[model samples]
Every structure is written in C-alpha cells, then in structure tokens.
Target: MGVYCSKKEVVEAQSSSFIYQRNRTTSLEEQIKARCPNSSANFEDENSHSTKHSSEGKMKCTKVCFICHERVRLDHSCTNQMVKDLEKHMDKDQLMDILMKIKQQVSKDEQSLVPYLHWGTNVALIFNPFTQGLQRTELARNIPEFSRTILARENRIFCIGGQDSSTMKSLPTIFEVDIEEHYRIKDKMNMNQARFHHTAVYDQKYDFIFVIGGMTSNSMGNQFKMLSSCEFYRVQQNEWSIMPNLKVARDTCAACLFDSQWVYVFGGRVQFEKRQLTNVIERAFFSRIDVSQWEEITLQGRQRIMPEFNVGMCHQVNDTELVIFGGKDTYNKQTREVLYFDTSSFSLIHRKSQAQSRKSSNVDEQLSQAKTLQKNYSTAQITVKDFRMPLEIEAPTSPFQIANNLFVLGWSKETNGIHLLRLSLINLNWKEELDFTSYLASDVD
Candidate 1:
C-alpha cells in the first residue's frame, strides 16, 4: 500500500507540470495576438506583412503590454513565456505600480541628458595676427545690415543692431555664428530697442554682452536720436535686461572694457538742431556681475575733445591707460591723431600724430603743423609728438583687444580694399594682419 501511494504521488506531480507548460504556451499565444492585432487574423498574412515592412525598413516588432504598458521586443530568441503568464495573473494595482516606477526612471534619464555649452576645443582661430593669415572660412551668412556691432564670445561671433535693408531703419534683430561647426548661422533673441552705431563689449568671466549707447529711430519717425539707456544680455539665459541709464546721452562713441571692472565710454555726439559733440569720459562699474552705477571722470585743466561719428577706436593699453585713434574733431575733420588717457588721473596725457613716416626735409613743416594743432587745444594738458602708424591702416574702425593684441579693421585707400591692423601689446607696434577684400567680395556676390 505504501509503494502504491508513492507511485500515485509521482504521477500527480508529472500531470501538474504538463498542465503548467500548456497554460504558459496558451498565455504567450494570447499575448502575441492581443499586441499584434494583424497576427490574430491569419498567421500567414501576418508573416507576409512583417516581411514587407522589413523590406521597407519600417518593421518594428516591439510591442507594449496592455497590462503594464511596458515595451517588449518580439523575436525568435524570446524564451521567457512565463512573463506573459505572470502578467495575466497580476492585479491592476500591481501593473500600475510597475508603470509608475518605469516612468520615473525615464524622467531621470532625460534630465541627465540635458545639453550644456561645450567649452573644450571650441576656441576659434578666425585669423592669425602674428602670421598675417586667415583661416579661409566664410562667414556663416551675410550680415543683415551694414555698420552693425560685432561681439565675440567663446567660439561664436554675434552681429547685432544694424539698419534693416528693407526699411532703411534700425533693427533690433541679432544673428550668431558658431565657428566650430562650419560657421553655421543662427538668429538669436532680439534686443529691447532697435539700435545702430551702438557699442557691444563681452565680459568673459560672467558671459555677458553689454550694449552701450547708440542711436535709435523708434521714437522719432525717420530721425535717429541718441540713447542714454543701456542693456545687457546674459548668454546662458538668453535674456536681456535694461541697465542703469548712462550719465550722459551718447552715440557713435569709443568704448573699451578695462580690467574687467569698468567699461569706459568716451567721445560721442548728440544731435539736436546742430550736432553737439562731447569729450566726456564716463565709466560703468560692475558690481556683483551687474552694472551698479556710473561715474563721470573729470578731466583736469583742459578738456580735449576726442572723436565722434563712429570714427574712433579705443584700445586699453594697461590697467591704467587707454589708447584712442582716428576720430573726427570739432571742426568735422578726420584727424589721424593718437591720444592716450590715464585712467588713474582721469586725464588725457599724451597726443601724437599717426603718420607712417616723416621725411628729413619735411621735419620742420611737420613740427609747424604739430604746433598749430597744439594751439587749437592750448588749454589741454597734452604732449603733442609725431608717431607712425602702419601705412595700410586707413579709415580705422573700432579697436578690439584679444589675448593682449589690439586689432583694428579699416579700408585701405591705397589698395582700395579692407585691411586688418594689429597692435602687439608687448612691442606696441602696428602691422597689417590680413587683407579681406577679395574674401568679403566673394561673400557679398
């Protein structure tokens, strides 16, 4: 009787295993039919359709379970038939809990994939001043308007605030170029006000571009008016905010960033009935990464007017000195005079001529002209002397400093082309860096 009981138990166990295997196979077949409705119609039809989709490169056999909504890739290697059986036994609450966990994991993964500004190997070498060579890459696109303000940050160049070609009016539109990515052009956020003849300076430490005084025609129908209000743009945030009003309304001024602490604006013109010019020097101080206040620097003794009408360039020579060049005087005459300002004393300390050469026979004549020029500003404390500039630099534009070298772009009257003039801070000598007329002409065409 004991032997008979043991044999009966073995037979019962084998039968139970066979029933479990049959149930699992049935559950898997049901799952496949539910997920792929086309397969429920006919197996041969489903196989042909899948073959056609695969030929078209559109076959996606993966399906989401109705119970848990989890995607499962279906293929011949699928050996987990028990998963379908287990899902059939699961309650709705258990399935919902599994889905919630899966959603949370997906959210975390997406958050971790947020892109950041890449800083490695993205520095652009547009032109080499020391080698007098260009990289031979085209601008991302044609500038929307002429006389726009250009500012550089990281591996990008931004062109902002110029006259619109269609309306012949000032534009607030901004454009950017990524130098590392084949110089791809992209439009960026617009400024609060449409401006032209404005100045832009980038702060590397904080990644801010401050747009200073310029002329805008928004208020007066066709006439451009000077603006004292300023604005700064945060690059990372892609937002713009108004800064404190400048101490004086100015336009067509020469501006420079000094020691990362102050932005000096010098020599701009205000037009009313007649054009009024100023030689005022004012500074906007950066406090806690934002412009806090502005202070006007008084020039002791006499005030010698600098340049106006977008004619001058300001290059910071050191922590305490700035060199200014090529601006129109009060007489509306373009002068090739170089002026040095002492920031410590807030004074114009030196004045010199920017002539390439002076013949021995013409020395007395040059001296006489220098004396005449000095007499025009007899009250100013300036030492007038003859200093030479490179012959290729003509109609000099604003000067920008990069890596201790000052660069000035201008048109060469002799070559009938555009030239880039570079001044090395170490040697304080000017040299022709590159000629960009042919390259620029091709782009314009």
Candidate 2:
C-alpha cells in the first residue's frame, strides 16, 4: 500500500501547537505525526491489483512547512521557536547565518525611522542624527565645489552659486540633494548670475530664494569686485528674476529671513577691502505688490554689534526673535559670543496696520503707514545669550534648526575634522554632537 498526504493535513501539522505530552526523544517530524494523525495516510489492500493501482497514482507530499519553507513549523512565534529548535540540529555557521539575517532586517527598519541631516560641502554629507552615522555622495552632474550657500527645506538641501575650485571661476550652478534617496543630488536651474559668498534666504510662503550681495569674481586667491545687485529664484516657476539691489556692494555678508517677509543683511566688508568692516544693517520688506527698496537699520551706539564681516552668523528662533553665535568681531578676532535679537515689535504692529489699511480707499493714509513702517526698523532689540560657542570651535556656519535645538556646522583650527555643535533653546547649553571628515573644510578658499 502507498502512503499519501493531503495539502490541508500538511498545513494543520505545521500550524499545530506544541504538544506538552509528547515524547522528548523524537524528531520534530515525528512529533507532528503524533499531534496530527491525518498528516500521513496508509491504505491496506486485500489484492495485489489494488497495490499496483495505488503505486501508479501516488501524490508526492512535501515535508517542509508551506510558510518559511526551510523551518519545521510556521507558528506565530516561529522566529524564537525555530532558533531554539535549530540550535541543537544546526552547526555554528548555520546558526550564525540566521542571526545575520535578523540583524539586517533590524538595520533596514531603523533606517526608515531615523531622519537625516543633509549638509553640503565639496560633496553632500548625510548624517543620521540619532545614530551619529555619516555618508557622502557626489552631485548628479557636477564636481563638488566650495563657497556655495546652503538652504535646507523639508528633506532637500539646495546648494546655490559657488566658485569652481579647479578653474577658479564663479559658477551659477544649483544642485538639489534628496536626503532620503541615498543622498542623491540633481542639478536645478542655474542662477542668472555666477557669484560666490552671497547669502541665500528662502521665502517659505512664496517659494522664492533671494540671492543677496556677493562678489562677481572668483576671488579664490585675489580680491574680486563686490556686487550690490541682487536677484531671486522662483522655485515653482523654475525661473530667476532680478530683485531690489543691496544699498551697499559687499561680499561675505551674513543674511537671514525674518517672519517670511523681511530680509536682514548684517555687517560685511567693502569691495576689495580686507580690514575695513561696515556696521551697515539693511532690511528689505516684501509684500504682494512688490519688494520695497532696501533700507539701512538705524541703531544707537550700545545697540550696534561690533563691525565685522563674514562672521555675523544668525538664525531665526521664532517669528520675532533670532539667535546669533560665533563670529569675528571688529578686532578681526573670532569670538564665542552668543546674542539674541527680538525683532522689532513696531514692524509687527506696522504689518497689522498695513493689512487693515489695505481695505481703506484713503490713499494718503496708505502712504503715511508706509513711512511709519520704514521708521520702525530702529525699534528692534538685541541682547546677549547666556551661553556661547565652545572655546575650541570657530568659523561656524549659520545655524539650522532640527527640532528644539539649533546646530551649526563649524571647523576648528585646533582640530582637523568638521564638528557639529548643538545649542539647546530650552536650557541654553552647548554640546559637541559629532565630529566627522575634514573634507568639508579641506578645499575651502
């Protein structure tokens, strides 16, 4: 008589719960037979003819579980059960193979959950903040270059115009990096002008990036002509348009956007001048109609920051406040001073008044409100933050916020690699988060 088994019987045998009353010396297959009597079948034949017919029509039965076919059982707790059951049967190498598979699955899951910090340097560096893991990838088309201004939005990092290291020429190149896509970089629309050391600020509401004052020449080795001319890129339109020019022509000026409407340009040096730094603070107001001409902020003696160019690093803390950190002061010495600015309350009041005045047909009232708005720039406040940058770090970039804290990517002369320093908004404490490759600063001009 031939032995035959049904598909349903095999499934039941694999899924059956562990039988506590089973014999301990038997194999798992034998146990399955003990628990599931229907798994294997036998038919007794009284005649030789019946035995020949059964042998000709016999169906093959698979011994392995239908799910996770290599394992003996396919239960809800199969992972743990299989490991325990296989330890005695499997060799050391075979057991290690199973563990490695589990480890890979865990790593894949963690990658999907963690967020990345996309920082642009010669190449884009993607950092896992939680894991402190680092990765680097090249731009889709262009070679990694320096002097580019970086802007982060969502998971994308935009590298604006910068200088070409090899040819010593200013470039209009724009590269967009997607952090989640293995740090993949793709080229975007080039700027209307090629310049470096300019500040790029994004208007979140309008989806426009304003490229402010920078030098027209490469200036890698020598001084270049400073550009007061400014322009902006309309992200949705994929086009660039000229905007109101800066009042003063200068490069390496620190700039940030406030309230999604105001562009503030901090102190910077004049064209071709090394030692002289201007204390000029300019604010440009943006509205639906047009970009109002740039106006210099007027401040009394104690209200002004020390005259320094290229080092006025600041980031917006809120709609009305900003935190400024490490930068060179008037003495041309790098400082660890931290300061906060309470953006002009008068400006906010003027904005509200302007919105209300727009409904009125009185033309004179509208013009009067415009003049009042211009005069309120002096009402802004600046104060020192309780903590400063750690003494070892210097030449910090503008701050970028991740969550509750703000981080600055900086380099140290005393140390070789690039350092990411974090500042807590809650406790005002400074912490060294991670240190990585010096590739970020090695090729800087």
Q: Lowest summed lDDT over 10 consecutive residues: which window, candidate 2?
A: 376-385
Tell me the RMSD of model 2 versus the true structure. 23.5
Clashes per prediction? 0, 0
TM-score of each: 0.59, 0.58
Error of 2 at 246 (Å): 0.9
lDDT of 1 by residue, 1-445 (tens): 0001111122232233334443454443343343332332332232332332233222222222333444322332122343445458874346445545554444322111101111111222345442345554445344544344344444456767766655668878776766556767778899998887677776655777888887777543377788897888887777888888888887767787776778888887776447677777788888445687778887763445443434466767654677776556666655556676777777674334332244435545544544343332111212223233464333323455543356777655567666666665422446676666666433322
Q: Which ranges of candidate 2 are over 4 A from the true structure? A: 1-122, 138-145, 149-151, 180-182, 218-223, 304-306, 345-386, 391-397, 438-445
Q: What is the C-alpha lDDT of each candidate?
A: 0.54, 0.54
Q: What is the lDDT of residue 57 in candidate 1?
A: 20
